[model samples]
Target: MADNAKWYVIHTYSGYENAVKAAIEKSVVNRNMSDMVLKMEIPMETVTEVTESGVMKEVERKVFPGYVLIKMILTDDTWHLIRNIRGVTGFVGEANKAIPLTEEEVAALGVEKHEIVVLYNVGDTVKITDGPLASFMGTVEEIDADKNKVRVVVSMFGRETPVELELDQVEVVQP
Candidate 1:
């Protein structure tokens, strides 16, 4: 069942995505299908807004409106339950046929679960892989797991500078 579980899109009424998600979850619980229905996710992104007063506010922006993504093992019973749930219009596929997302598509949509391995240590030499400082080698100054970011000290012209970057933007270099 675990191997078969995959993400599928369910079309819902406009502005009713969350409601449909809750209904599906309730049905899963009432029908004792926890093993089949793994998870329901509504993808969101953080949008930072700067006001005229120079204040910044972060807001959650739904990536897909009127659609909810679900991870589940597809079966007749599971499909029927999901299709009949309140606020669910239908699956995002051909008529009456549900298609699961491909592995590459899932990863591109940020729906796949990936295990991140930390390979670099503090004071280690690393090469910047992305952003404005790309291709530059820097020393890891600090690691912050809580924020999933790393601080690195890079040589900028003649000065040593500190830069904060996402964990993916750096690769450890051998001394």
Candidate 2:
């Protein structure tokens, strides 16, 4: 039985995140399982390292030292393929049931790009998803696709206040 593709965390040997990801990815392709195994990532961030001599260099550092994220359709075959990877320890789930990541969790982890699909048009009502104006409902005043920004007129303190937000920061409210 196959499940919808979602992000699942996997435990790995310390410092072997990349190696395990490569092995699983290669297996997925070699087995012609592109539809099953979709994405794999070892979340990393850049940091400046300063040496004793005051030489500063930017380096990519793993955010989660011993884990990898896989976006795949969960199934018996896929599970076996992932488990058999050389450096993979196990899935980051209770017992043997793999827990898929929540959309908010994935966003917080910065593992995937958050896509905002807004059906609301200019002069339509929308909801603020993130930022200081979170949960505030407002009307769309303007949209700037080039800048990926949207200007919404939100009612505050008995007045209409215009707010600027990223395209991904607002959602269309269904009536």
Candidate 3:
């Protein structure tokens, strides 16, 4: 089932990352294995580079060369589908076995992002729910949803101290 899908890393030839990904994708589509093979990705990052002409340009570079990540529900048929793809060396695991990445590993790799809903906004009173400031009540000074950061002004030692915390670290103070 889709709930069983997990991310696994696969190795390919030095320059065959794209080729291997395409082959596996095409095969999945042909076999109607969309439910088995949920998603595939070649992690890439954009970097600003200075060209020979002194012009600045953004270039997309592979985060992990010769590696592709696939989110799939592991099974013999799915394993064989990827194994038979041209240019694929094997899955990154012990004795050619595929191991699904742990939840922590997946989060560290930034392969998936969980959406967060912010209930409190600027000027609202919130209570710190995490970190050293847990149980501390503060007034929201600023909220940056894009960066998942919030600036809260809390009264400490009779003085107002502004602290920055993660968006999820605070909750609206119920009336």
Candidate 4:
């Protein structure tokens, strides 16, 4: 295993996110590939939903269905192990070739970057970069600095719904 590990996307069967993630983790541990396989993640977000009792509940939902992200040092052996994992369809690169993601690309995709930035504070206006609110301008209602997230209000379906957005997915707008 090399010191430089790159991120890559793995396509899995839909609704098998947890299964694939578990399988990858088990494989890494069982095969003693901890150094090569660093992190396995199924990016998810919490959504507030109204229950039948009219109480709002927070539910965690996958941001990208049928997809999992992994950080690993790519090698023939490492690739073989990950590719053979159950529930994984294939890597998201050229056929039979696993292209690891660059640091910049990973950061842009909302994955943790090596270099961290101070997130925008409350009351700051910012432009949404990705997601359904992309290109929409909104003021930060609150900042969860520790989590690198912010609450922004965007008009949806004629109502202002507050959405929690990752810091990297927003660019501060100066008035």
Candidate 5:
């Protein structure tokens, strides 16, 4: 609800991940608790796997086996509801307490994607604002929004050096 909801990790029995997720989703819809149980996710990744027949195939694999990520407002009712679910062993935390993930952890897990807008384009002069190369001025050479990567050519030791940086790490240098 609003900003109160936080993402929590639920541990489950191995091989029952999908079943537990489905059951919780069904319960949420039936109980009309959509407002409290905001979202559920089983983070996945696609990998190229070689089959026994020597054919390369792309397969979707769970990033975290036996674990499900849930974004919800933690309360007694919601906690009991989820804890009682068939396959859920418990929430990941200390002393049986459910600890919500921090913003950095959530971002690192790829549960949510933060949209970043870039004001500088290739050939634009910008100043690095973060990381080891902070405060260095450079010319943007390439921008990859999908990966949030930017390649900049900076003058170091009086020689041009190319460095890869995050999109948010640089700001456009004004005329």
Candidate 6:
């Protein structure tokens, strides 16, 4: 059902991701826009930090702050409803045109789409495919199986550092 809905990014006022998502959900329900409006989400990641008491705490924080992903079939009425929602600024795909996310791009984002592979696991060795650490090899420190993300340590400036990256962005290389 979610895959049938076209994905679009909605820009919201800073610190208003949840509010805009809720407002859109409520509007969709009240106006009976179920056919066009499917699902809404605020992408978040868990982060651990030390508190004043010297205790480590894990909290959920937005991966892309002030942005919410909406899976829906865009129509004039649906667009009107979403645009009029409080805290919503605009959509990200186009200025005047509503460009739907391609299936591959949406799938790569690991939102509302199934992962294409389950090849790598924690302790598996992989080579970075892109980014600054490109071509560097590292062992997977953690695996976000659901989101298809992994934390790997690469030698940067002669120091080993861990960095989070998408699963698809790395290639598993046997040692």
Number of the top candidate by TM-score?
3
Which stretches in model 6 have alpha-carbon errors above 4 Å? Answer: 1-4, 115-175
Model 5 lDDT per residue over 1-175, tens place? 4489999999999889999999999999998888999999999999999999999999999999999999999999889889999999999998779999999999989899999989989999999999999999999999999888999999999999999999999999999
Error of 2 at 83 (Å): 0.8
Q: Which stretches of candidate 1 lie over 4 Å from their true place?
A: 50-56, 118-175
Q: What is the lDDT of residue 98 in candidate 6?
A: 67
Local distance difference test, each candidate: 0.90, 0.89, 0.93, 0.84, 0.95, 0.85
Ranking by TM-score: 3, 5, 2, 1, 6, 4
Model 2, range 1-175, lDDT digits (tens) per residue? Answer: 2357899999999989888988887898899998898888888899999999999999999989999999998889999999999998899999998899998899778777645565678998999999999999999999987567899999999999999999988998988
Better of 1 and 4 by lDDT: 1
Give the winner by lDDT.
5
Query: For residues 86-115, what per-residue lDDT tens digits would candidate 1 score against the true structure?
Result: 888999999999888999889778776575
Candidate 4 Cα deviation (angstroms), residue 170? 20
TM-score against truth, every candidate: 0.65, 0.72, 0.82, 0.62, 0.81, 0.62
Tally clashing residue pairs in candidate 4: 0
Task: Give the per-residue lDDT digits (tens) of candidate 3, residues 48-75.
Answer: 9999999999999999999999999999
On the 0 to 100 scale, the lDDT of residue 101 in model 1 is 90
lDDT of 4 at 134: 96
Candidate 4 local distance difference test against the native: 0.84
Q: Give the runs in model 5 whose Cα sits over 4 Å from its true position.
A: 127-137, 153-164, 173-175
Better of 5 and 6 by lDDT: 5
lDDT of 6 at 18: 91
As for TM-score, the candidate ahead, 3 or 6, is 3
